[model samples]
Target: MPLRVHDTRRREKVDFTTMNPGVVNMYVCGVTVYDLCHLGHARCYLAFDLIHRWLEKSGYDVNYVQNFTDIDDKIIIRANETGEDWRELVENNIATYYRDMDALNILRADKYPRCTEFVDDMISITADLIEKGNAYAADDGVYFSVESAPEKYGLLTGQNIDAVRSGAGGRVDGTGSGKRDHKDFALWKAAKPGEPTWESPWGPGRPGWHIECTAMSMDSFGEQFDIHGGGHDLLFPHHEAEIFQGECHTGCSPVVHHWLHNGFVNIDGEKMSKSLGNFWTISDILEKVDPYVLRLSLINAHYRSPIDMNEQLLKDAEKNHTRLMGVYKAALELMGINCPPLPEGDITSQVPLVKSLGLLEKMAQGFAIAMDDDFNSREACAKVLGALREMSRMLGILEGDDLGAYAQHCVEWLEDTAGSVLGVLPTREQTLVEPEEDPRRAEIAQQVEELISRRSSARTAKDWPAADAIREELTALGVVVTDTTEGPIWDLL
Candidate 1:
């Protein structure tokens, strides 16, 4: 398959004929470990997770690498506030990140390089840049000579570099005495009192934020790779700097074949932040709703479109997710009866639940087409839901008999191809916690209610032993029964 991906350099679609046949090397910017993962991070990572799954399904050998910015200012500040070691802070957050990713069913990357671990590599790259006259060190720190690089610095973002150069003057944290221009960004920061530092030729210090990625990417994926992805916010100075570092050192343009960026997520018409009090932690939301609801809400919007995070959107997404699962179950049941026997050398034994092999196959095709058309997950998801609704009505998995043997076979294939391969499913076993009011829950509630009523009656009748036994049994089952002015009520333990 000839994949067409959006090339940020050209600001247009580009054909992805690989430099090495059937092999794709992808690098994505990962979370800075200052805080817990949020929905915004979910959107960015899940989008690429889907891409990774699709590439593998299409028979491409993919080498996916993501990095941890474990040495950023945020991590330092967080550690200082808690009086903990900076490395400890990052390690704890990294552990939390893995748990969240596992819960979401996002696959692990082939390599998870931490910025601190690659300090030597970063030093080498910075030295190379200095030797090539693309960077310089000052009394404060080393900085990249942005103007020394090629004039195509703004090509990827389609912004004129000169137009924005003036306002950028105030943004530089430290004034690098050797910097020829205000737009020059730091390559390394000189170690300060009580800050993390490593020995380097330039002095004792650490790699700057942008330089870490450039060095790590070069070390892991070499001079060029198939794809580079991150949030849209990184497109301007960060990505431009990365391109500059790669090209100035290696004398190559278009260091990456494709660039992908997911749009920002907004909460209540504003970007999420600590100041807004609307910033939600993944752990916080997990307590209130299942993770799949969060995943569905993120993927429902186009990966490049700004998502307005609101309760209405999530409620609708949850309903859609439930309806989709219900439909898939129904379709499987229908296939059992209606599907024909598979001939030899066939992939599926049953007729596809939808006109396609399964609703997912059609969705997968549509998803590829949308992604090819600039990663439009919104349109692709709409088409998938439509097919799901149609097939669900025919199959009756939600409220019908066991799927026929043939339908079961088709369901397994489609579920694996779509759910496992694409990272989109109505219900994953890990995220599918029983609802508070599920029938089983209700049954337990009813039994508890009956027990409370019986206990009340038993107490009134002076049968103290029966009442005590009922209360103990209910308590043992995680029901804290209590009597109140209104009536008896229970709370889940």
Candidate 2:
């Protein structure tokens, strides 16, 4: 099946094809670099990272470009509040951005152009807009005249000129004064006393938020590209203004072939917000959750579907991730690959040998089918992981020569589909290191053993209530107790 994507501009799912046959020039809107990134930022980047991986896996040379808005009103405000230089603030935030992204294993883009680096290009584009009568200079700065291209006002948002003018569909840029129309957004702003200033045709000022993206993207990939992606919130004035500016400047009708927008991240049942006390930074979440587990939780839902993040969701992802890691480790060991020892109570048992012809091929095709359908990672991940678990169960039953070959095939299949495409699986070398022993391991083991002894006594005495109470106590301490034919066994949760 050919790759299909949901185009935000057309508001439909369409077959994805690049302008160049085997090359994709893609651009994604990046962070503003004012503060630490949050869950929403993780979702947006992880969505694009998935697309990037699938594109490469499907035999496309993807030239992905993601920009950083280093110069912004929020950056200035944050710098002022901290009494730090705005440049220093942006640098620190960008460093932290890379730290968080690298921790999550997101693939790096081909180009990461900062807004400050492209100020000259922005000035030139703003100047050309003024010369072409698409923008006008006012007392405050330069503003794009929506009247100049009324038909292109709401190309992405589906808003007409009346809707935009009424402020019903699009955001009004209220930074600059003396605008001829309420919908006319700023191209450049006049310099303020303490803010960063740059030399431009419209006096000493900085580029506006929207213009920075247009200048950086077009400069990188020319007037047209294959894909432009961002969060759903950027579908309005931000992207709408980009369409207008790009078309008006380059005389290109459609600046991009496909526009993709990922859905929002909701906390509990409501939108994530600082005021709601549900705003979670990526660093804060990483302090408690494993990076791979967090990645799975984020991609469990379709990219276009809202993900209601909560404790249960993360816990479910953690369980699934642990299962995958266990299978991977066991498969490696079956193929004579040395790996870190599994937990004390974890055991692998041989199942009945079955016909395994075409199994790997079938699983690979199934994964591709799910991913080809608009990057449905939720289905793709489930298909791959479920098949791997079954394969691992059968690893012990294979004969001498067939055993090694089959185990190798299973490892390769997992590496290609889940490791390369989904990026949820760590490499064998990455997982080979022995984890540091916990200081409380001896104490916790003693407690667990004592509780299990008490529970066993209670069970033998026919005291169901006491046994249940001890079991609950063990569960609270993150231990899972199971009854076997011989005796009760326990494992750390």
Candidate 3:
């Protein structure tokens, strides 16, 4: 099947008929960067990366954009709590987010625009709204007239706009910003003391939470684009607001061709939250497990399905990741020794293995079909995994010259599709860093080395308790010692 994906707009499977054939303009909402990224953030971005990768593999040139909400209420609050400048906090966390995502092999977006940096564009858009009589400035700030747009403003969230208006009206009638309807959201907020401010047409203040996305997206991707994606939670007021603002700003029928929302990463059966104390920072999990394993586990379930975060699930993900890698390695080896040239005339016997390319092609086709059919990543992932397993049996072993060659092909294919296109895979260097150990730490390393030698002697002599005690001591010192078929190898955990 051609690149069919379920467009959330129509609520049906449709081919991703790009406005321009062979070129796709894709955009996804990125992190706000006030805090460390959580598992929920990881799943959303990773799913897009896969889509980006697969598209590139399937021969479409994708121009990807992910924006950062740097200047927001959360950032300001986080900055004050930590005694750091708000902008500095945003920059720091954004850097950290990049590092974690990079380690997980997620590709950097082609453009990562920040809200604060695009103040002028925001002013221009806000001015357009007021000029069109769709917005008005009040005593405290400027608000978008939700009533001016229409009563059907809650189409995205499927909630009643009138109910939302009546409920929000009584809460904060600060300084008499007379909104025609209670559902009218802010476009600009009047500057509060000690908060960041930009020179706007309304006054020196920041863009409102929802307005940032509309302004930045229009500035970067034009009035309409192929896809707009974010967390499921944003489907309501956030996304709905964007649609209303965009359509008002530009006389467009649909602000986005497709709307894709990934499901939440729940902890246990409940939603993860700070109060619940079940939220896992992506970086925190990275320290305890292979980052790829976390990603694999995230992908094991369909992207749209809720993922429960648990220790048992993580452990299974690690094992499953290793198995997938092993299979990929095996396939590469087999293809290296016996596979024919790409786009070449081939003979028989290798058909089952070589023809497995057709299976992979089918899986790719199925992936597109499922994706077009409501972004069904669950079924698409199954196809990819199934094809990977079938091709593995054709290889003689997971390592050797043949395996290496086959691996190179698969890696190249993945790089072109998953890395370049999807923006999912990080670079494969294996080594993370070359460090300068502290002198005292170096001395401790030596002591650990000596202790390990003694432990090896104990193990040789079958002194089980002594060996176990020494191993435990080493582990306490932040050392991880592994016993491979080649014997013990030690490293700082």
- Using TM-score, give the best candidate's number: 2
Higher TM-score: candidate 2 or 3? 2
Top candidate (lDDT): 2
lDDT of 1 by residue, 72-141 (tens): 7788899999999888888899999999887777889999998888999888889999998888999768
Cα misplacement distance, residue 301 of candidate 3 (Å):
2.2
What TM-score would you give candidate 3 relative to the actual structure?
0.78
lDDT of 2 by residue, 210-311 (tens): 999999998889999999999999988899999989999999989888999999999998999999999999999999999999999999999999999999
Question: Model 3, residue 188: what's the lDDT?
Answer: 89
Ranking by lDDT: 2, 1, 3
**CA deviation > 4 Å runs, candidate 3:** 162-180, 330-375, 388-392, 396-493
Residue-pair clashes per candidate = 7, 0, 19
Candidate-wise lDDT, in order: 0.77, 0.88, 0.74
* Candidate 2 RMSD to the correct structure: 5.7
Q: Candidate 1: minimum summed lDDT over ten consecutive residues — where?
A: 394-403
Return model 3's CA RMSD, one decimal.
5.3
Better candidate number, 1 or 3, judged by lDDT? 1
